[model samples]
Target: MKILTIQQIIKNIENEVVFEAYAEDESFKIKIDEYIPYVCAAIHDGGQMRDDVLEKCSLSTYERWYEEDPHTAEFVGNFPILIQGCDSRFEYDLNRDPDNAIYEEAWGKNVWETPLSESQKQRSLAKHHAFYEVVEALIQKLESKFKKCVVYDIHSYNWKRWDRPVPVFNIGAELVDHQKFGDYVESWRDGLSLIELGDIHNYTAVNDVFYGRGYLLGFITNKFKDTLVLATEVSKIYCDELTGESFPEVINQIKEGFKTAILNHAFEFIKNETSYKVSKQVNILHNELESDLIKIDKQLYSLVKDFELLSVINPINLEFEKKKFLASNYKYEPQFKYNPLNIDPFEFKRKLSNIKVEKINDISIQNMYVDTINAYFDKVDLLANLGTNKFLYNSLRYFGEPSKKDVDNANFVLYCPEFRMEKEGEFNENEVVELFKNATQDYGFQFDIEVSDHIASKALVINSKKKVVIKKGVKFDKRFTKGLIEHEIGVHMVTTMNALKQPLKIFSIGLPVNTLTQEGLAILSEYYSDSINHDRLRELGLRVLAVNMLTSGKSFNETFLTLMEEYKMAPENAFYLTTRVYRGGGFTKDALYLKGLKTILNYIDQGKKLDNLLIGKTSVEYVDTIDELVDRKMINSPQYFTKIFKKHLEKPEINPILQYIFNGIKD
Candidate 1:
């Protein structure tokens, strides 16, 4: 590549000093060849117009009058690039962020002159914005080929006109770490020490001296986070402060200082390390970490991917950011109980995992017995075909006396008894009706009490012919409402009715190992009702992480230790929760909550009704699998749930508003 020396760059600047159109010349062509220098643009005095003296002037007097002046226009056009200082005099200011009060610059007081013309706005943008773009393109080109660029930001200020005490050398401070580009500034400062006839303190560097509009620094930092920007606010001491006239000797000394700083820093950054080397090293580390992390993620996914297989589905797409990956419409989770081989020793490098993994403890089984019984009952209820079975009806008479219409051959309920009392104390029977009321209300059920001294509570059946079974003395708490509403009315009852409505008896025989869909629907119901609070959601989140941890070679004890000891979760909840996710692999249920949330949102996005969802209808099957079912005519409505759900293929276009509400809602 051709290289231009500092003298050549300076000579070209001198030639262009007259601001006339460039002539075709060898020196100009040579100077412009193969490189672009960086320019730090700073706008000064941006605060004054909004707060004080400049506010007395109208917008027209400041913006138009200031730019139209031939001297000011010539000064701007002269520089290869111009950095703006926070100047409140021209427009309320460009240095302050647009979010700042000064952005609209309303306070420039004179209302009549405030409205600016289109031409003036164009002129301002051309002078200010165009400077940055030209410099940026040059820098990018240089960095692309030679792997580095240099920026020299220049400004002039009054020697003693500050609100605060002045420093000798004001090296515009913010967060400039001069050491980043191999300490180029040190050489310039060292070189200046030999030439200075003044005291050492006269060469100090202080920040925020003449802070300009935030744009110059903001734009440059955004593109090259590691690129160096050196802004020097030169004191007007070398000139006649009142008249802006120069003292040749003093100006030369200052110019030498500026030139030295620029040349030294540029040479070091370009020669010390090529941009390609730095970027290459960064890219390699990123790729290696990404590859390792993805392998671990897929391993974790394998454990739960099968959990949804029963529903015959897979995720349409999975997205990964930093370290977390999200998959929607997942079906199955692999079993990872008591397995010690899946854990990755190097996985500790990522912290997002901390939010989702845990270990088991003794109290993990505190709710196990009840859950097991419920599971057993679930199995029994399915075996007897409770929806259409007379035997099941006879066993649940504790609900009350069942009317004849309560049971039909197809298991349809023509009518159900209304037993809820209007007032708590109105009932003559002095039983714990409050508890019974609370428990039944959760399932959208209410029943009348019938008394018999000889009744054995455990064996008693209520409303037998109606197929209503109420367990007597059932205590109530928040869980009762949740369990009944979510499991009974939401899943069991709905599925039963759906079966009765179907011409096929197999639909009522219970869904086949459809745990994922069943749990997904139950959770969705809880979410929609606002019953799934943050704590409940956290538990679900923990399960997700636990499944991932377990499937990736973590042992039960290791997971328990990490979750309860390291993460400090309640031991019991952590243990049992971890087990729930890994139950199939001893780790599968973990993906249900996230997958459930995604499925419910997908359903709504298609503009489908929540009522249809209540009818035990869900979209969980894989796209390919669903297609197979559709082709075989095993499923209908290919245009409804299936079509909308299939739209997940273009998930990137999903509306953010709908997504936020759907995910935020609680069950």
Candidate 2:
């Protein structure tokens, strides 16, 4: 959190232009943390080479040359040392691309002139290659631990050509993957407040301006595509034009902006695997359901042609065991075990569609909230009744009065109903829904309100047409509605709509085993300002706390009691809410908060592009088993909603802490 300091950052840069430390602070530690031994090694090598080059002239002559405006001398002095331990040839030329003997803009000089000077050539190869070789080795080592790696080949460029005018910052002129590098570079632009001067200095790779083909880029790209090489070329504005004098102000600014950019990308790159893993897992699960319903069962037809599913042919028992293991683990987690009702895993496993059911309560809220529960159940039943073979829904009838177990298993339950007397007149339930629709169009989502006379508890469900069923008299507070909209419409409905658009209804029916990312994505939708409010943030925070509690093995009763007695939540409210946190015993609510936060933050960091999170464009671990199917085109993109939500997604800048967490590789 401390402001930028010099030593911490300069020590990390291959060439500092000048070696002077100014101001010590925490930001320095963060910057220094990103400097692996590479900076030291590169500088050390460059130093040694400088001495060797200077050996040709006398000490007096060298000192006098240096005295004539020492910044260039300082740079030359540090250069050899920086690259000391590297292979001056086979590895990286530092000044030129490794594959070429001459720079791309060497003014047509035959830079590789000494055909007979094998010794000189070998020395160049040995010295230059050593630096790049060490770089390559370091990259490989880093890649083993991370999903990607980055190489910041630091250098300074004179903006004013002898024959031309000076330009602004020269971002490695061209051949760079703009899509992959744009975000990070943009971060630099923001951090530095640099003005755009058109594309004057933005030459593509190997153009007339300072082109070097066989440099670090060649070595880096050849071995690893994931390894990003940034050849930063700072202008000579910091040096005296006539005498090449040094200016501390310019140096400080470049160091600050440079450090920010590197640290930012480094953090994201390191955490990339975890996020991608979770996303991929979700994708796999999504694709699998589509495949099972459309390809195997042949009950649903594809609405989109490219939708494909990747199937894993594990033995049936193994699949069952895996599912059971997850369920058991979920149930045993501290937050999940707080429920009082019994969950029948048998009933859950017996039903093969993507839906899961848990018995939430025993106090006869079943018949008590029949009006609400019945409508939800019947709507799901209607879908099943409609000849959809791939998607299935199971119900967990509450066996006991609300308990920790019950709350954990069910999404939400209606407290004993508080009847709201219509201001004056009574209307039919269907008519009421139409009225509500007209009233809330300014909001979003169309609700299919069904007042159930037979039900005591209020529950919610979404049908294929995207109509939501809520028991009448359920308190329509901001929390309930926001959570409902985010979970149902954003995730379930959108995914369903996309699936339906697929040439096959199987994808439309539902996705299997996609709980993690599905739930993560669903919960993330609640954070948007358009949908979320103070009440929603509170609910989400509690959910996160619940996940932490459940994973620590808190029982359902304990969790319920804790929420009510300790957190001072209302008894009925606490009991009902605790059930959700404690369900699946542990795994149920555990995912909604932390995992959801991570997913949402990542989406923002990636610029709020929902295409990846929604259209299944994510990694296997972070997603479901269905990714393979989507990859294979077994599942198709949703035509109606994908584009609509795409613009709303915004990738936010990576936070420094998370970036610090991911600094391992970039360092």
TM agreement with the true structure for every prediction: 0.29, 0.33
What does candidate 1's lDDT look like per residue over 87-184, in tens digits? 33254334333333123343343433345555544544443443344445545655565555555545555654567756445555354554564365
TM-score between candidate 1 and the true structure:
0.29
Backbone Cα, N, C clashes tallied per candidate:
70, 148
What's the residue-level lDDT of 39 in candidate 1? 38
Estimate the Cα RMSD of every predicted model relative to the unseen true structure: 28.4, 23.0
lDDT score of residue 222 within candidate 1: 61
Q: CA lDDT, every prediction?
A: 0.38, 0.38
In terms of TM-score, the best-performing candidate is 2
